[model samples]
Target: MGRGWRGAAARRTCNPRGPCCRVAGDARRPSRPRLSRSLSRRLTVPETLPSVPWRGPRHGRRVGTDPRRGPQRRRFVTLAALLALTVSALSASAPFDLASSGSDVAVEVPDPAPVATPEPEPEVEAPLVVPAATPVRVLIPAIGVDAPIEVYTDAMVAAADGWIDPTTHDVVSWWQGGGTPSSDPDNTVYLYGHVSRLEAVFNYLHSVVPGTEVTVVTEAGEIVYVVQEVLEPVGKEALPDDPRINAQVPGRLVLIGCYREPDQGRRRTTHNIVVIAHQVDSAK
Candidate 1:
């Protein structure tokens, strides 16, 4: 065999898939040999190579990695290990909150959902009316005048045809359109009587002095009122317009009665008296 063939055959026996080998100068001294510099450069081989444990073709279950793929496998394993360590640290630690100061890393956090607002309630206003109790009788003790209360419609109290004699002789007429004594305080209790020649009803109305107590018996209860003022010499048409009578509607009692003899010529009542009173005690 040729000398080069003998050396190449020996190298194949030693390393089947590894590196190239050099021929020793002497066979007796077993000196360390190296790959040729030109061959190593041409093959792009590393300076140091791992030793192969076996001398034959690898059949089953290779002990180590392939030399060609070793560097890539090692790099992949290292990267995987670093990734595992970073994931473990992130999961085990608390949440990350960035500072106002500048940073290279950015963490995304979603905003919370918006809260719903409730609308305000509307304001309610109080009504100006209340349940009313119809008055049935009125008694003025100072004048010894105890009379039945008569509710009159607007047209009746107006007496366009003139005040009826029998209707006003011994009875008191209540203007139903006005206030009820026991109801809303703002309503004015208007009661009036005609002057009778028998001196029965309002014939003595002029004698009813101030501070006199008047009692009103209603279907609801008894309401007591004290005389606050008396307006005399009032005309029948302007009697209701008096400031004292108009001002006291709430819990007030107003009494109207014709004064002096009727004018036979004019066929009309000449003078009238008006009494204004306020509630002193509430009915039980």
Candidate 2:
């Protein structure tokens, strides 16, 4: 027989002794078959194989090895690449100012300009006013006396102290040193006349009652005064020192004249009469 016949007979032969018995008539088992070159190459593990962390069983699948994990793994890699590119682009576009952040460098910010404040207006003082009017005429309606007035200056005569000796009885005399007829309440205008002289301007002045209105005309205009008082007769000797006859007190108008007593006769004048009035109205 050929080798094939021998192999067939070997397979068919049985040992009379059990499987562990080595009997004299037993057929030897055929030698183990050897793999072919191609098959061996396919089964052999490569020495240059890439290293991989060992995972058990199902977890041992490499990235993209499973059909479900293939697309997911590719998307993850793509997203990572895009995120890196975005970060790099942002960093390049907006660079930090490293030089200004240094410890030795100083940054300056300008102060705001001050607001313009307007200055306050200056205070202005009023001008001082000096009155310039002088009495030109006198009128006492209650006594029916109206006469022109003349400013009698004491400096006109070397020996005269503003006292006038009337040459004519038709005119009245005003002292230049006395106050002018004005709106000033503290000032008093003085007028002097003689009742003892013939046809005197103040001949009927003693007859003027307390309620009479007196008008004194000046270059400015007429000033009206209501009689406030008819003073008692003052002796002629005490006339110079009498405060009633002077312009020192608060009076608008004052009329002074020699007083004649009915018992003392008309020609003999021992005392003087004073009439005081206050300004009521004026027309300028």
Candidate 3:
């Protein structure tokens, strides 16, 4: 063997997989040797490198970081912390309000003026006296009654029922003691007619409805009246003493007739029918 081969062979030992060997008395692979303290100081970097603070771990896992990246990583973390603190302080200060922000500003307003009112005027009075007129004719178109009216004075005697006998049954009698035909509310006009005698004027006076129109003609003008009520049949014997028949109601017209009913295919007078009417104000 050559001298170099003999020297290499003496220093080496073999493993089962290949011709591999380690240095004598060495426990691990060889690395570059560390320098002595005195020499390390002289060989270090001239500029100082910042270092990151040591925190144990992230969550439960160990955090591995390179010491060479300390300066950049520490600067970035400090800036982020300062930004977060500024945001939290601003949010916690006060509620946002637009009106409160401008509370120091001033505004002006003007007042309203006064108003005036006017006074009222006075009223005048009118007269109540109505001119007099005597009733000459009576017209009731509802029961077909158009008859000439005649005055019944002390010369004529009335029956027990206050009925005066006219020259003919077709003629109607008006009591002179009763009211004259005008729009006077203080006067009442009483008219009477025969029902059982021939040519009777008020034979159908009981059939007159409450709204039938009755017109009384006089030398002055015509006075209109509206039927108010047709009183139920009263006893013929009780006419003079009956308060309803003798009532002195002003502006009223009361007509009296015999109340007849069907008896054996003919009409027989048994009671009296009284019709009450009110003067209309337009003719007054």
Candidate 4:
């Protein structure tokens, strides 16, 4: 038995074509691990990973948040303010019309009332009457004689010296002697003064000529006279008595003075120069 067992064992140990040999060959075969291609591709890790900052927010994280939107909002606000100010200025300066025909009426201006004036009073007049009698003042411009007329009297003739008769001073010679009428209606008013004496008041009377002016100022009015004639008699026979020298003639004056001789104090008795003048008008 032993021998037969020994032979079987040897056969088992050295067999190339038996079931035991096949089992040994299976044990020496390479094991093929299950290769999972899908899982290996899914789990792969990159050699260089992209770097990212690990901080608060990512660069492109929020939706619709552009950086330029704030300045654009400020610009839109400024434009709106400018437009509002322009509209306010235009509304404040609007024009207006002031005509009366429209619903907007104008104020009325009334006409001024007429003014009244007062009347003036009338003037009164004085009554007509003769003024008081005042002595006539005679002015003989040629002889430089300006003296008051004096009535014929002894005292007045004494005052005039022997050139005139003391009692018959200022009286014409024709009026002195009673032969001539005392006063005639149509004759000249004669006045007489001595001219022959050296100091006679009428010393220059002979120089008076026609057309010489004489002024007679009296209380009533002034009378202007113009010389019309100058008379000088030749001799005592020519000294005829006449009432015409004593008359109250209108508009006439007669002046008489004695003629002088060559010898002193020897007067020509009859010859005289007479100045005749006419009255013109009243004084101013």
Candidate 5:
């Protein structure tokens, strides 16, 4: 519609450095310089943009000389330059580096104060052992029994089914293969006496209870044992198999006896009773 104006499209860019716009080419005042023919064909840019007065470098950074500020060139920096500045600031305030200061820094590593390692504890010696003497007689005041204890080896016991012979009605049979009353194989000395309802020794063994005191004489002196428990009656077959009867006993005295009723009223041989006793002290 005008003599000097040109229009090829609705929207276009005049140039990157200038005001690119749309729909209003003539909206620009004629007081400013005009756009070039080539740029006008490419973009619809305003002929004049708003201007700002430019100041020089801001805090050591460059500013544009375009006499304006709105389109000032942005400032940027590289990693090397930023890192150099950070290191310089840190070096001014940080403690001095010993490595950089070298030998004159006298970085003395103290000789670790002599660790007083305690002298190794001296080795100890073992106590000398004296074998216990053979046991002799046994005395149980609770049951009025003070019988002679005769040596009865396992062989002798086998002949009597691990019991005191019926003929020896008043004596106690000490199991000989077992260790002495004070020595190890658990110090278990098995002793059993004949029990007749009428006259045999240990006839009252079943009546004994816990805490009964029994004393035995050994050639070494006298050893006293206190009854710890009175176990329930065990059958003759099971009695032979008991761990305590077969030399597997712990360090305690095991007294065994049978219940014999006179004349088969309730059968003469009933289940055997065992009285377990533990030695409390010794008298030399």
Candidate 6:
């Protein structure tokens, strides 16, 4: 009996089916066949399983894989992509310092100081007063009328050698010359007298023709005029309206007189003869 019991103990140790053996008596040993059968069944099934609905991290549910580690790997991949894009963009842009390439560089520069311009001065005009000329000598060769001309006032005329007509009663009205007191140096010097009545005065003035010579002495100098034109017309219609006639261009003289008629009474009635002459040369 003792030997049989010892043999049974030894067989329990070697035999995997022994009842009292530790390895054979393990409770998980019964599931070994089930694990092998499950593995065989998994091999026969499809490799892919039906997908599960995913929820965000706020929920306590966990992903089959580690959720934190998956998002970290995706973020690392996105960062790598962004870094690559930034490097490519920086390489495509233009470089600075283009002046060394012989091309013009646009840079702002300030302007220099401006120059000042000068204004013109205003003009000054002369005063408005009648200018007086110095009296020179008068010459009338025909009737021995050569004499010195003076500013003959009424007192001077009464005491002068020449006599004025009693009818006209005018001393300055007899021998006329010079312009209005308002005229300038270039004004006309007109002379006039009665031809029919004054027998010694302007009776020979009618005989004067073109190229006739007449002499005048002025304070400035002596000037001689040659007859240029003779005009005869009745009444005021004979006068020329041109103001240039008043403009005594350098040396000019105009002589005026009334025509004579033996039948006409003392009551004056005749046409006026105007002779225009220009200076040829100065009498030295």
lDDT of all predictions: 0.73, 0.74, 0.76, 0.56, 0.73, 0.54
Off by over 4 Å in 4: 1-134, 153-187, 234-248
lDDT of 2 by residue, 1-284 (tens): 69976566555444667575443324565555799999999999988989899876775677656798777888999999999897676555544443444433345759999999999889865422324478888888777888899877767433454345555678788877677876553577778887864577888888888779998888767778889889899887887788666647644788888887766654677788888888776655
Ten contiguous residues with the weakest lDDT in model 1: 95-104
lDDT of 3 by residue, 1-284 (tens): 69876576456555668666655434365666889999999988879679889987666433445665678888999999999887676555635432465532334446666666666666644333345577789999988999999888755764424456676788888888878876454678888888864558988998998999998887676778899999999987788788877878888999988777655135566688899999874343
Model 6 misplacement above 4 A: 1-135, 140-185, 237-250
**Could you say which candidate leads in lDDT?**
3
Q: Which residue ranges in model 3 land beyond 4 Å of their true spot? A: 1-130, 158-163, 264-268, 282-284
- Best-to-worst order by TM-score is 3, 2, 5, 1, 4, 6
Any residue pairs clashing in model 5, and if so which?
A: 12-43, 12-44, 13-43
Name the 10 consecutive residues with the lowest summed lDDT in model 6.
165-174
Clashes of each: 1, 0, 0, 0, 3, 0
- For residue 144, give model 2's deviation from the true position in Å: 1.1
Task: Give the range where candidate 4 is weakest over 10 consecutive residues by summed lDDT.
Answer: 176-185
Model 4, residue 36: distance off in Å is 99
Better candidate by TM-score, 4 or 5? 5
User: Per-prediction TM-score, please?
Assistant: 0.48, 0.49, 0.50, 0.40, 0.49, 0.37
- The TM-score leader among the candidates is 3
How would you encode candidate 5's per-residue C-alpha lDDT over 129-154 as one tens digit per residue? 32476777899999999888888777
List where candidate 2 sits over 4 angstroms from the true fold.
Answer: 1-131, 156-158, 263-268
Mind giving the per-residue lDDT tens digits that candidate 6 earns over 1-284?
A: 99976565445345557655454344456645445776888779787989988875585556655667687888999999999887566555525343354433445557887877777777855443334344355465643445444343445346544332223211113133344222244556565444655444455676777887766555655556678876654343434454435455544667666665567677765466567877566554
